[model samples]
Target: MLSLRTRFTALLIISVVLVLVIAAVITAWLLRKPPEVMYDRVLAEKAEFALLLLRADPLAAQTLHITIQEKPAKDRIDQDRTDNILAEGRRQGYTADVVVLKSFNPHRWDIAIRLDDGRWAYLDFPDPAPFPYLPLAAYLALVAIGMTGIATYVSNVMMRPLRILDETIAKIRPDGIIHELPETGPMEVRTTAKTINRLATRLNAAVSSRMRMIAAAGHDMRTPMTRMRLRAEFVVDGDDRQSWLKDLDELDHIADSAIRLVREEISPAAQEQVSLDAVLRSVAEEISETDLPVEQGAIKPVLVKGAPFALKRALRNLVVNAATHGLGARVSLSRYGGEAVLTIMDSGPGIPQDLLGRVFEPFFRVDQARRQIVPGAGLGLAISQEIIESHGGTITIVNRREGGLLQTVRLPLCKPEQD
Candidate 1:
């Protein structure tokens, strides 16, 4: 389906051009008949005026020098001839077109005028051909050309505001900062922009509220966490003490993850041109330091438009999550169509079928019963999805047939704006 802007432009331009074309056609048709009518009127007037002069004085006919003859000398074969003469003449103070006659030349028009003495005055001349069609066709062609240009110009002017609206709406996202729409253009366009700005204001306020709650919760937990850590220092060294410290450490990890999530949501790094291969290689190199058996596949210099740090963090999160569950991760980056494709595969046991779809939810954990295996909260996949999607990308995780979980991320290659 076409977008609203596209539809409007198409409809507007087509309607205008069609109307103009129709008008031009009708005008051309009407013009064609007028030439024939005008010629008949002039021919009748000339014959009538000559009849009037002769009726007043018979010698006036012989005195006339204009080209009128009882029989044209240019006559050839009598293939076409008339059988009547003055019988078709009009006597009601006006003259009609001349009547045809048998004696008239076959190739020329024959006109008969009734004189006062009840005699027939025969006049013959070749018919004037209808006006040539080329000029009329040219006039219509010019009209069509002008109509096309006018329609295009009008459509562009009208669709300009809607194009701006589309661009503004596309740029709106939870990542980075919210930018207001430009309240300009036509009245309807200005209204639409203001409405979008109001909606953005409401959305930003909601996000701010949630982020403040997360920040506050993280802040409030720090003092108690510190006091608990200090108290644990007095405990005697034992397995139970180790378990308590581990549990507290996990709680601290959750708080820290929560704070980072809120901070990232509030302000992801600004977008810029960055190399996808570079970010993937850097993240894989750091993960390899932990001896996780991660491999960085051959990557090209695929420059993407996004925040480099945010993308790096997203890649790191996917790798770290895969490493924690699936033993280790193998990372690779490549180009597909107009998108940058990033794949992360892990060798550990993949998530259960029932929990696979829910893994990306905030703080969702598949291994709830195996908390000791992984101490962090279940925000890694969720955060990674947020980061990727904010940059106009998609992240999906599926279990590989061979083994382990496979995550695929695809980000659209940004195009430059035209001047």
Candidate 2:
């Protein structure tokens, strides 16, 4: 399907051209033979005047004896065609009922008129082409060019509002920033913009509501979670008690992560210009301090608009996840096109193809049995994704073909992707 602007512009051009062509055809049809008929009428009148002069003087009629053919001169002036020509000349107010069309040369007219005095008069006159052909062709060419210019101007006027609406929609975000489109165009355009704004408003409301609910639930669970932890301390020193303590600890961590996710969603740190290279390096240094085999590649300082703390947390999550599961990590930062890209490659056994997607789901673990060994509530990737997306970015993880997993994060260098 064509876009709105393209469709409208095409239709406008076609309609104007079609109208011009149809109007020209109709005008030509109505005007086809009138000019030729008028010329024939004038010829008959001139021939009659000459006959009248000869009738006034009998000697002159014999002296000027002009031959008149009763039969047509040739096939070019047959009886039927001659009759039709005579009828047209009479219709144009000429006394041509008794006039005979004798011959029609290329640029000459020859007609015979029967006089009131029982004499025949033949008149010969020069005839040029019926209409101004070359001039009219030039005129039509100018008309076509003018029509094309008008069509383009009208297309721009009709589609200006839609262009503005599209550009505004492209900058939409979930960060409570609602850019209102101009509602001052045609009625349909204004209505469309209003509908989009209303949808954005409802989306913001829904997100805020979810964040509040999640934050409230996590906060309310903290008291009971602490009480449960305190109660676990009294259990006998055995495997069962140890398992109970571990489960409690996991629950507390999950509840804390829930609140953290809600906070990041609802009130992300204010966006500011920050060095993307610095953020990645900071996360790499912290991971290296823990004796993890984390390598930070040479990175050029790239500036982007985002919340520094939230950005760092997301980078750290990817780095830590790689170090934990992939055995080691290599972090690199670069600018690609209009975006800043951070890549984390790990050298562990790659995640199963089927489980790579589920790894980002909250509480989803690729290797469930490994949970007992590597302690985490499984919210790292989920939280990281939410944070990156909030800052107008995307995070993706795919297994490396060689032996490990690769995670790539791309953040827009300019205004975030709101659409």
Point to the candidate with the largest lDDT.
2
lDDT per residue for candidate 2 within 1-419, as digits (tens), equals 88887788778778877877787777667646456566656665666566667568756755767664353445534465456556765676655343445454767776666766555566667775555546666776788788878877888777876776677767866445567666666787788788877876787788788878877888898899789778877888778778888988887888888888877767878889988888888889998999888988868668889988988888888899999888999888887777888889988989898888787788888888988888887889988988998987888899888889989998888634221
| TM-score of every model versus the real structure | 0.68, 0.70
lDDT of 1 by residue, 103-139 (tens): 4443456556555555667766676555556876687
Q: lDDT of candidate 1?
A: 0.73
Clashing pairs in 1: 326-348
Clashing pairs in 2: 172-418, 326-348
Where is model 2 more than 4 Å wrong at Cα? 26-50, 53-168, 174-177, 271-273, 301-305, 336-339, 348-374, 389-394, 412-419
lDDT of 2 at 18: 82
Against the correct fold, how does model 1 do in TM-score? Answer: 0.68
- In TM-score terms, which candidate is top? 2
